[model samples]
Target: MNLYNLNPKYRILVTGGAGFIGSNLCESLLANGNTVVCLDNFATGKKSNVTPFLSNKKFTLIDGDIRNLSDCHKACEKVDYVLHQAALGSVPRSMNDPITSNDVNVTGFLNMLVAARDAKVKRFVYAASSSTYGDSKNMPKIEDVIGKPLSPYAITKYVNELYADVFSKTYGLETIGLRYFNVFGRRQDPAGAYAAVIPKFVMQLMNHESPHVNGDGSFSRDFTYIDNVIQMNIKSLVTNNTLAVNTVYNVAYGKRTSLNELLDLLKEYLTEFDLKIGSVKTTYGPIRKGDVPHSLASIEKAKELVGYNPEYNIREGLREAVQWYWNNLK
Candidate 1:
């Protein structure tokens, strides 16, 4: 009956749509009969990620920088929804170049917010991060309780939420923030210094390199899958609840998986490819600055408010993710 249908003429703008999470969102939106306009600067995003969908009639790509106001405004023209995902993404990388990171994550986010507000889009959905928890000792992090930001990147993401709230109050814009927790899956790049732990560890194990485990393999995360992320985005964009507007949700599976457990799971999944592979040995390194000792989320609010249900746990997510890496990258 096409109950989930939106206006076929509805055009959506996905900034950083060539990046991992953004590209996945773009693909999902296009599948559901929406015109997707993707704007990317290719800083951390790769062209290959978006190449497969180039010929889609409803998809358009604009190779542009979000740090530039003109580019942000150009992409927002005639868009019904704005999914802002472009930013400098890593804790360590932000430490190395805090100025550039702030420029892109903070200043650039402000630029996008201004553009989206002026365009008067139906909704603005953004990729917020769990790193906003900072050094808070809470086990299951609630949206209300937060601590001082531990890193430049954390500061940037937290600032996004702040600006979104202000935009909603001042400009009457509809904004939803999804605070993602260690999201990983297919097409997640593994070949960089700032590579996420899941992909980076899988790649190292595939090549028989010793994977480094920081801080005794005890630090944990509430790793979420890409599909769950997509689900949250869809719900955020279309929800009828007034309470959801100008609100932030913890987008995660609500389960904690330690680093040691994750590595063991990866090795077990990858061994099916080559049983004779070397033992997956990991070297312990000192803990990193700005790194949270542990992270877990209380997704109760998201569940109650938006009907947000995460379908993948760590094992299931890693299973699918490792298979993708084996098939494509290996």
Candidate 2:
């Protein structure tokens, strides 16, 4: 186990701090006695996500856009570290509106990097996606080997890492990227058209509707839980390991769960609430473009470097997530 020498009086900045993962990060930091400044434009983020933190004296909210350099500058002021989570996610959505996605995910990310560099932030940690591993057939993907990006969203995330590396070499800014794989949990909005699978499935089950499975339902993914992601962010902020700096890590459970098995599991868990909900008849659609058949992460590097240990598998994480949606969202 690796121990981080964290500063007790650090003030950290979290961009997109009102979104699902960002909100959780903010909450965890405040609980640990750190002062947190959250910058969010609420583009995809909701105000309610950060409402609970308003009462915390250690928490400060900055309503701003990352695309605006001034807003990024203002947010980074006096911050020790930055956890950049702001981005336009989803492959299909990006395929639909590539230009807007590029503006927010690419240009906006660059803006944050420049601001963080100028502010001399200790480290700029940003969210890079496993989508960057596009077209790579290698199982348990290693960071060193990646294929060409398959979508506009993938292109944007890949660009974030590319720019981070360039900035580190050029301006001497410390940066780390976490390549997140199918992250799911509470506050993940299920109402949107481009909602993630877990929340969307849970919502559909709550509505007593048949969940649609794209492709043959054999498509697998390394579905990571939110709490694990929270751990990675905290570790990235405080780790003083020289070898750990200016690199990327895979934030995942290092296990793959298939869609067919996932649907069955969802039905099984939801059945506890309503026994009438038996085997759900799922509708299969054509395989979506830019989606790989399976995704699994080789987390040895993260484990060795920053002591990244994932505590939840898909079933355990989904069980908790389903219960949350049932009690709060239903």
Highest lDDT: give the candidate number.
1
Which ten residues in a row are the worst by lDDT in model 1? 1-10
Candidate 2 lDDT by residue in tens digits, 231-284: 887788777788998899999999999998888888889889987566557889
Stretches > 4 Å off in candidate 2: 1-8
Error of 2 at 95 (Å): 0.4
Maximum-TM-score candidate:
1
lDDT of 1 by residue, 89-160 (tens): 999999999999999999999999999988999999999999999888877999999998999999999999
The residue pairs found clashing in candidate 1 are none
The C-alpha local distance difference test score for the whole of candidate 2 amounts to 0.90
Estimated TM-score for each candidate: 0.97, 0.97
